[model samples]
Target: MNITHRVSLLCAALPLLSGCALVVNAAPASTATAAPVFEQWRETQHRGGDDLMTAGLGLEGLRASVAPVFSSPALPTADEARRRAIWSSWRGIADLTPGGGFGDRYGSVQSAPGREFSAYARIPGARHPHRVLVQIPDNFDPARRCLVATASSGSRGIYGAIPVAGSWGLAHGCAVAFTDKGAGSDYYDLDAKSGFQADGTPATHGALAFVPEAGTAAHGVAFKHAHSGDNPEADWGRHLVQAVQFGLQALDRAYPQSAPFTSANTRTLGVGVSNGGGAVLRAAEIEGDWFDAMVAGEPNVSIAGAPPLYDFVTQAALLMPCALLAIDDLPQPPVQAQARPLWTQQCAALKANGLVQGDDTDAQAQSARQQLANAGLSDGALRAGAFSTGFDLWRAIAVTYASAYGGFAAGQHPCAYTFSAVGADGKPGAATPEARASWWSEASGIPPGSGVVLVDGNAAHVADDPLRGLRCLHALGTGDSAEAKRVRAGIAKAAANKPRAGLPIVVIHGIDDGLVPSSMTSDRYVPQARAAGAQIAYWRVTNAQHFDSLLAFPDYRKRYVPLLPYMFAAMDQVWAHLEDPTRGLPQDALIETTPRADAPLQPAQLSIPVVSSR
Candidate 1:
């Protein structure tokens, strides 16, 4: 399919549902009409609505003029200090550093026979007691070597996902070390603050803080359009670095207490999805020497890499209010130079395809003019008034204009833009057209990427939209056009700053992911790692979504277990090459297995545990 056609197909797949559900498959089915596993999966999804509510999602009844925003404070209280202390203590024991080389250490948690366990770590500046969740393996081994994994986010404590999976890892003779990043879960709370401020000032805790303008085009597009201000890329990157560093300290402690110390090699790899995937990149950058390899599943490396249509919509939101309403629009050059490439390419493509015309013959152009008429603007007015002021009004007006011209608002009515055929005539489809219409808004000044479509507020929430906008603007550093360049430059700088001399890093992203785009992985991360001469693997799954590809194993627990060996084995090979550069990238390190989490863990029972140290 063509780029626009492919883009439309991808957009159609982005349905928003709050909860996640898993479906397990039966051993064998002989029935003529056995339900597809995903069909069963949907049942679980339907039942999960309640869980989503508790997780603070999908409250459709609630209305807001704007989203809530926040900022991060220093690890404020003594209680916070106490928690850090606990984390530090556990980290110290898990350290596996070698021969007094503090930087070379790693961490591991192993279960002993009889459900007893030995936890080792190396905590820096040893000071306080820690509360750690140690999983004791039923079948512990002193003879077999182990593999260790560090989680990306510490906002949530170490007890959840990693611990559960690590438990299984221990059963198979691999030890695991998880880092809480001293934030200890509660990711939502931390992100909420970092995305905004308490008193409603823009905070410096988010990705936008690193950018120059400090709330310009990027944040504006994000807040007004997407209804989400979470900058998972930078937030997760920070957490990943902290986690890996702490995890290394934990690994160092594991040695000396155990055998052959420095000579013995146990593989280490970083893995995560979405934000977690972004974390893998951060960890690879900071803890390059610690791991043999890393896997990033569907991470968006640069904000600009997201689809262009979204950006245009956000631009419209910002420009419309200021130009048409005289509210002071963001300055010119649109977004940063980095953002311009994709937008330019797409715009050119659209124009070339005749979907968007450069002249008056353009249907979109004709509709746009009609939309202007509905918004109470005449040709003289269009020529006289600024475009930024009343941009949203103009957008609404445009839809009315389109309707008056027998066209429907892009998203609201399907019939207006609908047609049969797969070529340019109807090729991009209704969704793409909607995205384009939204892009018109983003092209102006509206928040293009914000996920919140509609919001409501009470008397107390009177400042809701403004406050939310302020927080988003501040958090994303999106006060003006200069800010857009700043955001893009920051990502480039971060990518440039890192040197890659150790380990193989492979980033895999699904093209259709609604949360994070695959382009970020392919465009920014792959290039950065490749420039450093790091062994880099960048894979794009055609139609995969966020984390759906990660946790979808058929038998989940049972089937995924076997792949652990192959994954770790790849790490071992990569580590060998890292230790000895003359050896080059390992040939056998590439192992293809099921890409989805739903694949079954095959060959159920095993009496032997194969442990390899290179």
Candidate 2:
């Protein structure tokens, strides 16, 4: 529909703000050229017969009827405010320690006796230390077989690893601690910032974490809302590296008790979704010594490529906003072909506006032409190829988050928190007009790391290369650009040396995903890992989204008897892997159960709602 018509329809559907008072005049005799005939209701006379007009009730009386529920309290302490702010913002799995401990020291285990907590630690430049949670079961016997089952988090919860953690303790009978790897709200505290700087804004603390306030434990720092000013390298690559390291650390701390596998000698596995899938690859590469098997579901590893994040952005930029509002509106092949230019325009827009940031601008897109030429493309073809792969993920952000329950629509605008520049007022600034001039503007680029600039992107997404460039310019000036490049080069060098693997890794990805493109994982990532000789086991969930595969099947509980050997056997595989170092992958099983009669299956619908206002 046209904008005017749609707006009018929307306005008509909405309830009016308030009723307006109506004024009427009494019937009067007028000249033919004057006013038309008018009719009015009779007025009652109060003292005599009964002629009186009842006035409409005023808002004054209505105002006194309702009472406020919350009362303003005294100003909170800096510490209290920080805690409450953190707590209120907390989503997903909170603290997932093995046998909970109070504070300070890694105290003796009181609950999960032999279990150990593996922490994914991230200490960005000048920021406070924040870690993702990973736990391992006690491995009293070193030779037991094990399986690393990596899990993705639910759409509204922390990383699905928490379920792995809980199940390991109860049903699985395994030593496992899932990762709260993403800087999103699930498991980490992205807001765990260092004190404020002279500008009064929270200093470069940790990068962005994920969002949603559903759970208790804080995962990694919510990088989605993080400022590039503080963290020059805000790319997911660095976070992935950190995730690998954190998984290793958790294994190291748990040692013989939880993880019996010798880092230098034993096998390991990996797994996860979108962010988790990215981490799964990194874990296999960066911690190759620890991961022997791995799997990824709808991973968004390469922003520039045909990953879910890439496709989502591509579709959003080109297609109309309401196109994907309903499932039936999914774009067909012809529509997808039309969106290609929109994605290209988005990249051009980012570059023209210098929206790309940080020091790593020279990595992929920075030298796309030269790289393409080296890879055997002619200048014109190279340029075309470069344009084809540029990463402009802004559309992806809007597409992934515009719905309810997603953090962007929720109070914690994770994407805006990370991308938009922050003003002196502590409020994040809006995107430049130039950036927003086109409906297909590129979103913010990933941040750089100590040595690495951007993490994942392609030549087509040229603008993502400089996501942190403006921040760097604002903070360090033009001279820092070269320095930033050098730093990224160094980081790449370092990351190359520390290839992921060497830890227990398990990946679970669905074959059919509507949001995330499953082909990316099954085709690109898994094969790449195998080519690299990554010690990872992958489980392909036949049909599901990036989120649904991680949930425990309720039907499994209803139909099967409790404590079945197969159930225990499945649990044992997970437990053994968490504790010991033996090569094996979890058996992929379709959750068995009966659907309720009240809620009959709808083939046209993906029963689980992806977006929600509540």
Q: Largest TM-score belongs to which candidate?
A: 2
How many backbone clashes does every candidate have? 125, 115
State in Å the error of residue 328, model 2: 3.0
lDDT of 2 by residue, 407-444 (tens): 22212322222222233454443322221211011111
Runs with alpha carbons beyond 4 Å of true place in candidate 1: 1-144, 152-168, 182-184, 187-256, 259-266, 303-477, 481-499, 549-614
The lDDT values for all models are: 0.31, 0.30
TM-score of each: 0.39, 0.40
| Local distance difference test, candidate 2 | 0.30
Across 373-478, the per-residue lDDT of candidate 1 in tens digits comes to 4433333233222222222332332222122222112222211211111223533212222222221111211121211121111224433332232122222223
Candidate 2 segments exceeding 4 Å error? 1-120, 123-128, 134-160, 165-182, 186-225, 228-269, 303-315, 318-507, 531-542, 549-614
Lowest-sum lDDT 10-residue window in model 2: 49-58
Q: 517, model 2: CA deviation in Å?
A: 1.1
